[model samples]
Target: MATTNNIDNKRYQGLIISIALFLSLIGALLAFTFYTSSLLERNTALIDQTNQVANSAQAVIKDLFDLESSYGEDISSPHIQRVLTRLEENTALITNSLSAIEQGGVITDNLGNRYQLPNISNDARLDVAEAKEQWNVLEPKIQTYLKDANNIMVSSADELAQAVDQAKTSSLFINESLDKLTRDVFSNAERQATTIRLIQVLGVAAIFAYFLIFVFFFVRRLRETDAEALAARRETQEIMQTVNTGLFLLDKDLKIGQQHSRALNKIVGEENLAGENFTNVLRGRISDKDLNTTKQFIEQLYNPRVKEKLVDSLNPLTKVLLHNTSGTGSDSRFLDFKFSRVYEDKDIARILVNVNDVSDAVYLEQRLEKERSQNDMQIEMLTTILNVKPKVIHEFISNTKAHIEKMNNILKNPGSSQYELEAKLKAIYRDMHSLKGDASALKLHSFTKIASDAEDKLSALQNQGALSGNDFLQLAVHLDDLLSLSNTIEMLGERINQTSAASTKAAHTTPTATAAGVRAAGAIDSTPQANSQVIGSLDFDEGEDIDLDDESDSHLLAYYQDFAQDIASRQGKEVQLNSATLEQVQIPERLKKTVKEISIQLVRNAIVHGIEPPTDRRSAGKPSTGNISLEMQSVGQDFIVSLQDDGQGIDYDSIRQKLVELGRFSLEEAEQLDRNQLLKQLFSSGFSTKDEADEDGGRGVGLDIIKTQVKESNGKLNVNSELGEMTRFVITLPKAS
Candidate 1:
């Protein structure tokens, strides 16, 4: 076995030597590779420097040539002539403009270097001047010798070279040593040929040995690495699929590229967006645009002059682009799209377009906008409601419908006469006038606007004024609008009723016939004076209602006597009632009921109880008559009513004495009370100072009843009395709202 092992060892020696040689070759090759890479990097850098220098020099030469060309081109424009003339006339102004332009007044462009702008800055203008001066001096001369220009240029070059050579000692690039260095660097590859060949021979030997060992292990490891790479690619794809936003990948051609999410696929499939052009996609799914615009945006990719975003094709506001992923609209809920540039240099260069569906977010945003508009309208409605008196506004709605109901009445009785037409128009005018006053009082601008227009039309018709075709057309349209507004008020009023609980407003309050009578009776200024042409122009005749009664057959005395006799007969007692001013009283329409009720009550009370019997009146040295008088007067903001009787005056001392006897007040308190306070006891609710004794009638609530009734009519009541003489009550109530 030992001898066999020895033979085996000898046979393997050659293999071992081969392995050693292979390992040695690997180290040699790696070092050579590193050295070659460094040399290549240096060469690349030098080449880049040479290119930059050439490009810069070429740009300067081109700029100068452009300047010369531009100067030649602008010789005839009006603006160019103007600028030239001005420059010639005022060189100092141009100098000042130049100074202002030169002093750091420019914005640096994208590369952080200033390109003095053409219109406003000094550099462009300076170039213009320089170009102009040279061209002005030489252009005309050069044009004359055009064929011989090239020959002249060649001669000029020879002369220039000789002149430069004359100053050789001062030349920048022409020294002997510098010339040699430049030549070596730029021109001589063969100069180092032998040395380079030796290096190459050594390098080849080393590399051959090294590659043997390197390839064996490298090939083995490559298989394992490739397996890991496949696994990583699978993981990346899985992550993209699992991300929260819906995704739609697009190709550079802008077709429905690819979809990862179920939701995204459904939208595209439902919309038929897969093969449609992007701009015309508005037809199918409303990607909502021109396809060419979308394509153009995608084409920009990441052109730096614009935004440095991948979506060069679309608004960055609504869309975005990422290398492999993009989202649009709400970040949390994307309705946006992205176009990404990936690996542009390789054949794999592609646009990875992404889309995110933001339907719910967009819907919510629209809903909010709609709600805002509604809220603004609601505020306007509330402002309108605030402008009107609640009662008038309510009536406007309720009464307008009633007034419109009259239209049906007119329709039923449709008769046309010039006179009847005038009456019908006047009725319409009354309603319109009421509308105008109510609208004006409320400062309701919209309501007044509609009502005034209706009124003017009616007024024109009523007065037999001309109604041109346009006027009638406008009137019909306007009246329709007013009628529509009336219905709106009714609808709004219904809403108001639903929301408000405490209002005394009835549905409609119309003008009463009695109220019209009141206007007729009280407004005597409408009566014509004999000499006056216009009736109602005279001031009110105050003496007209006055009656110092004379004849018993007269209206004034007959009314008084009849009223008194009725009281006396009703009470089974004699009562003499007189009006210092009865027929003289100009009764308002609203005051008719109130005046009658108050007058009768006062006279009856005096006849029944306020007086003694007729015998007592006679004994008191008065006629056997219980005398009462009524007077009326108009005062500021109110009408005053006075009722006076000389039957038996109210006894104030008795009232104070009774208040003390009752448990309501102390004798000391009664003693301190004034006469007015004592008299007020008679008007107290329950406890009366006067009782139903000594053949007189009292229920203990007479004055209280009087006070209650007066207060109910929104009136104030007070009494003044003199013992055994006259007693009087004064009442006042408002005449208007």
Candidate 2:
């Protein structure tokens, strides 16, 4: 403030000085003008006096010659007297004018206006004194001539001639002196005029120099101020460039300021962002919704009534996903934008925007979240494995491993054409769907979720316009996850079996109980082939030779019963499995896996699709518990496995509606199809009556699996359904050699 005051004081002082100088210049100009006017007046007067004196001297010479000529003319003539009188008057005028020229006195013109004439220069005075002396000498002769001519007209001619000669010589000398005096006076006036002009020129140059000096100082001060401002701006630019965060100013119009941080370019993957509209900058980078919200948020910042902190949570740009298209390719980034109001005094002027690239941080956070979810899933899986029966878990793990292996093989040879790729996808989808169903039955939710996710991927691939090898690349990642999960479950299953074995050995109980415990443990530890061998040991190949009371056969029936009950409980239905017929007849070792696979799929399909919920059953005046019967028989060289469920039978109308809904067939075409054709449609891959797929039967892959299994086994499948009565599937396979 003191410095400012000092500068102000200096400015005031300069202004005062300038004013004084200007006034002095005006005064000097006035004085010079007055002086020049006075000099011109005096010079005019002197030249007028000089010209009058020269005119008077010439008149005297002419009058003197006229007097002598009058003497030669008639002496008695009146012209002679008139000439003498005019000569006396002219002589008197020349004497008075020369006297005025020689000294400072008033002179009169022909108009009788008197003017004061200053004393002449030395040269003019000398000429004036010589002219006066000649006039003094000539005046007496002129007077004598006038007296003589008036007295005697016929007097001595010689005397008259002598007087004339004296008058002529005197007159000639006086006129010569008067002419020299006139030249001298005019020369002096010219010299004085030149000197005055020189002075005026010098005064003008001095004023111009002063003005130039004032301008130089004023401009210098301005340059200093500009330098300070420029230095400050340079410093600001350096800070802006050095900062990592994108920084800029936004006005109320949503336009960016002229100056912005250099990092703004790098963060936004753009250049020359200055002066661009803020919305245009963020337009393509963010969603339209976020961009509009950001605009409003910034406008709010410019409002003083809106507390900046209160609206901070409403910032839509916080962790915004921006797709930057300014680079060679589109790059996605997560950016955080913060706005602060720039206040000038009490009013908000601009909004300061700070943008930061939070992609890495957000990505890291997402990865951490994923890891936590995966850990929770693993824990849930471990808990599930512990609660499940060892035999069931063992069988589930083996079947899952087989399905995953098949999927991996399918992925390995994705084929070249679109048709071939789609076929591979459907094959993998069937395997994944089957795996999902089994996992859902065992309550291994982690496995079921993975399988379901994989099925979704395959379904997407199947729906695409065309398929390529690259299209299946993402599926490989999902397969790896499934493979990893299966391995973890297998490890958990082995550990549980070992722990159970240890607990059984430590109990030291009865031999029978111990053997049962050993058998259960052995089943879990057994490989897929080993488990099949154990089933083959039952030897229930032919209907007459089977033992109904065999413990292994009972375990097989119990397995199916438990599986059916678990699926019913999940679907909110009540089911009672009657495997009495199945106990009487069993399949060969070669058909054990096929029969198990077929039975599991058929049982889930019945509980999920065929069985009505308990409330519905009660409302229909039927028992709340739905009945499912399993039976196996051998006819000649073929063994038949059958599964029947007594619930709401197959709804062919629902199948037809689903066909029309899926765009597979028009309504007229579907209505014209018979029951067998509808069933054939139901068995097709990717066909489902269910609107949405869950962990269970909605995938439509269950029946496809049964169809594939029967085909591979070189068997026949028969389906029978009585609406609202029952639905049954019979599978016939040639008896193993």
Candidate 3:
């Protein structure tokens, strides 16, 4: 197509050139013709002027001769009257011819009629002036003769004779001058005729040359166009036959082009699809929905309002699935369809459609998806074995079981009282939080997923300030999933345990050397020149008096101290944990559990939420390591567990915003809320200042669970914080009776 268009363009340019040449030739011919015609007209005028001069000269001469003869024959005859009139006419003619000779042509007026005289060439002007001089002398003689002849007297005969003689002499001189002037006029006319003929010949020759050149160019262009058309036809046939992909063109009306790949028939399951509407050919192969969608898509592709690529995603034929009906068996195949605009000149002339079979690719993707699921399961198992401690896993399973039992017991309670229901929701929230925390700590995503979902519903119940038994029943699905997963994980745990035990036994059995032999090998060789020496030794004083701080009494504090420091380190902060001695004050076993849980929760919360990192603390002109203190004491009937942190205090605005995010109140209402109300919402489930959920914090369930635990022990929890100064949580539990 491109070659053919190039040939056509060349032919068009050649035609324009030929037209221009032809116009130039015509213009030249017209100019020469006009010039030749003017020359011929001038020649004809000169010839006529010469002829008139000659005739006038002859007339004057004839009239003078007759007058002289008449005067000789009869001096007083009546013939003189006729001769005088004839001479006067001839005289007027001679005068006009003389003027014509002086002016170079027959003079004409604005009306194109001859004036008083014909114009003659100025080259003969001198001759015409001399003739006029001669005529001037002859005219008076003829007039005197005419006057004498008219008297009719014998005495006037001699006067007539004298007049006739003078007239005859002047007439001879006039005749000679007229002849000279006529010859010069004839010479000039001949030269003008020759010029006209030469111009005529040259103009004809030039026109012939222009004609020949135009014909040559025209024929050459025609031949080139034919050759280009033939070449294009051959190339197009080769492309149509050899290309494997289904390629075709569609016009604005969606009619397929005449030439298409042989593969098109196999792809579309149609033969001889050329000249047919593309939509019709596709209708039987693809669903009607796709057909309509494809029609609109192609229509949009033809729009010039935006770039084609911008709307490429709207193409419906992309990855279109078509059934392969050519084969004997009934099966489906996916064909990839693509479209692009074909431009002719600067306009889009057609849309090119390309189809390819992608069934193998589609099937491969399906298989890959199945394998990916299997890989995910294997990875989950590997993670469980690597990261989770057996002890944590065991405890998680046991605790989850107990929590589920507690939830079941709450559901089993038949009381429909709103207050009782609210209490049950609070209890359920604590149990779910504890389970979620254990799952999160152990990195068991499956358990955490189920527990977090249940926690969400229980939180909604707490927000309602009431709940029904049906609400508890709604939670059964999550609980069931958790229970089922727990059993599966417990079995896996047993298998893991068995594998560990076998590995330990195999290691013990594989050992060959005794303890003494190993020690001797480890002991520096004391042989001569050995390069090993013992640098350190163990010392024991078994009989010496010993004094050691009672670690048992401070174990709870120490464990939490270590926990705080570790959490701070992981978060890139430094922290110092200080605790008052609580060994002297007796704590009951149940109260001890409460204190320990509260201390662990508060300590972690302080480090995660309150304490700034070392950089922040130093920037604030404070110690690099934050300070966290745990103090326990009893006052009358209340046992106080106070936890304080010398770090950033609670931001009440942040708490308000969290409440606003949970949709409990608008931002305006939240801001208007009192500080006490804002602090109280810290115990609201799923309300945390942290933006993301992670293993350490941001679940917001810690304080809520702690509040539940305090309530169960008949205690009160109080929070006090000064911005940028300190944050403290005071827990007061009733002393055991």
Candidate 4:
């Protein structure tokens, strides 16, 4: 692997170097070409200027000849003046041109363009000097003749002849000198042209030679690189075929690279995965939310600033549950996808995805976890059963069985209409909540969790604006699980009971022990009747008949106390259950079960919601232990059951917030509701101020359960509270006839 990586690195470096060198060569060639072209332009411009100067010098000599010829034709002052004027103009033009040529100065052309000329070569300069000296000798004579012509035109004939002779002599020498200078200038320009041609040919030859050399080495290196790459590709293919992991590269666009491991096809359960959008590949296999998150995750991978290991925690693809699209493999699998950034220098290039089919390992882990959970539940159930009285466990088992049956019946009678379906959901929710309360009260966490999970499903169904029979399909599974759990608990309870009974029988098998055993069993049998007489003596309405006042009623009261304490402990609060008044009142037979269920739910509510924690209680200038008073008394033909807690009272503000959160009322509407109006929302189904539901009172169903039972018994329920002070619930049920 290291060797392959090194080779890859070397190839990348080589590619970079080659590109840089090619660009440099192009730049250098462009610069050299521009420089040579500029030099040629300057040379051409100099040659043109030199030709213009030479033409001006020749014009000077022709003007002199014309002056001399003019004197020969006419000795008139006007003709002489015309000749002199022509001669003077030509002379000035030649002097300026020669001076400019010799001394590197500006020379104006016919079109008024001024060009700065450089000094000519030594040979050309010498020729220019000689021409200037010859012109000087003729210049003074011409000036003298022009002055003499202005004074006396006819007497100047002799002087004009002399001037013509002087002009002829000067013109010969000057022309000779001018010819030499022109030749020298032309020669220099020709030499420069030759040098330019030579330089261009040499430069082009050098460039071509360099290009050939560059191509030779470049091709050689390229062939070697191709060979190395081919070897690496074969090695990579071997590894790809042999390795179990699914490997591929994902570009910034989230497209898979063309080269991918053979295992990727099997792991993703697809062929031709290359060049496909990664999101599309995972589209139907995973959830839309995970797919979107995966896109964002890969995007983050492309960002060089985000550290690979740091963002790894946010990877949504880890341990993804993918349903196989192909019909060949298992119906589903668990694939673990790991991503790492592929870097080019300091920049992120692509993401390397490593996929492993972790189905077997995951399935094994899940099986172990399931077994471990079962073992834990068994241990917890045993601990609970051993700690609790046999009668209590029996009562729990019976209640759970009945609740499960009620749920099953509700499912079986899933109504066709939306309202009826919603009603069915509520009914199941109430039963599940009741079951959860019972399980929690008995510390049967496994059953509580099952019940909670069922409630969660029901809650989801309930939240839907529309309902269908298909929505209830999932509920059947929860019901089945609950029923199975109840059976298991019942069997375990029976086994424990048999074991206890056998132990007792064994302990009392001796002859003397036999008589004591008989007496003990009789006392156990008559204990309910004995307690009934004791309850019958309590002050009550005249015709109030107490139910089977088994020690079960006392156990029921004790259960309430213990249940309150357990809930308080779980919520990190201190609570004292005051049921002295409740103990004295004889609950009528018909209302006994209804009253018990209502009391359990209400007690749980008070502990979970109304009651303040120990710290809050102390801060409220109250005792650390919160007070929960339960009282039942006969009033006229009715029995009034009052449960009050000296803790944080019903928070109307919290209720208003919950109302807004649940979308039952807008924020403005919730704020506008009075205390009396808010109280009505408290009894509404699926309404609670709590953010999240737990096994305890957060589901908001507890108060609804209370209201439901009260309505069923044709009882009146009232609630009153002072915020931060106390909250009370009053239930008034007519005495059973």
State the C-alpha lDDT per candidate. Answer: 0.49, 0.78, 0.71, 0.78
Better of 1 and 3 by TM-score: 3
Deviation from native of the Cα of residue 105 in model 4, angstroms: 6.0
For each candidate, give its TM-score against the true structure: 0.26, 0.53, 0.46, 0.75
Model 3 misplaced stretches (Cα beyond 4 Å): 1-388, 397-440, 443-492, 501-604, 627-644, 653-673, 685-716, 730-737
Put the candidates in lDDT order, highest first: 4, 2, 3, 1
Cα lDDT of candidate 4 equals 0.78
TM-score, cand. 2 vs. native: 0.53
Per-residue lDDT tens digits for candidate 4, residues 361-443, read 99999999999998998888888776676556666777788888988888898479988988988888898898888888888
What is the RMSD, in Å, between candidate 4 and the native fold over all Cα?
8.0
- lDDT for each residue of candidate 3 in 1-737, tens digit (9 for 90 to 100): 67769976775986887788788878877887787676666656655665665676667667666765565465335676676676676666667656665765455533576633334566567777877787676666555555655555534455445555665676566667667766776676677667767876777787788789778977887788789888988898888788888999988899999988988877677787999998876776788999998888888878877588977788887777776545643356688888998877667789998988777888899799868854664456446654543433555577788888888787787768887877777777777777765565445666776787887677567666546778778888888877877777777756655554444344344435553465468953322122112111111122322222221343455545656766676678888888775545556545755675566678778988999988888899989989998888879988899999989999988888778887889988997889888877888655789987554577677898788779889898888889999999999999873
Instruction: Give the TM-score (vs. native) of candidate 3.
Output: 0.46
What are the runs in model 4 whose C-alpha is more than 4 Å off? 1-86, 100-130, 143-160, 180-218, 249-259, 269-308, 323-332, 341-351, 414-419, 460-470, 497-552, 578-592, 629-684, 687-692, 710-737
Lowest-lDDT window of 10 residues in candidate 3?
A: 531-540
Report, for all candidates in order, the number of backbone clashes. 12, 0, 9, 0
Ranking of all candidate structures by their TM-score, best first: 4, 2, 3, 1
In candidate 4, list every pair of residues with a backbone clash.
none
Tell me which of candidates 1 and 2 scores higher on TM-score: 2
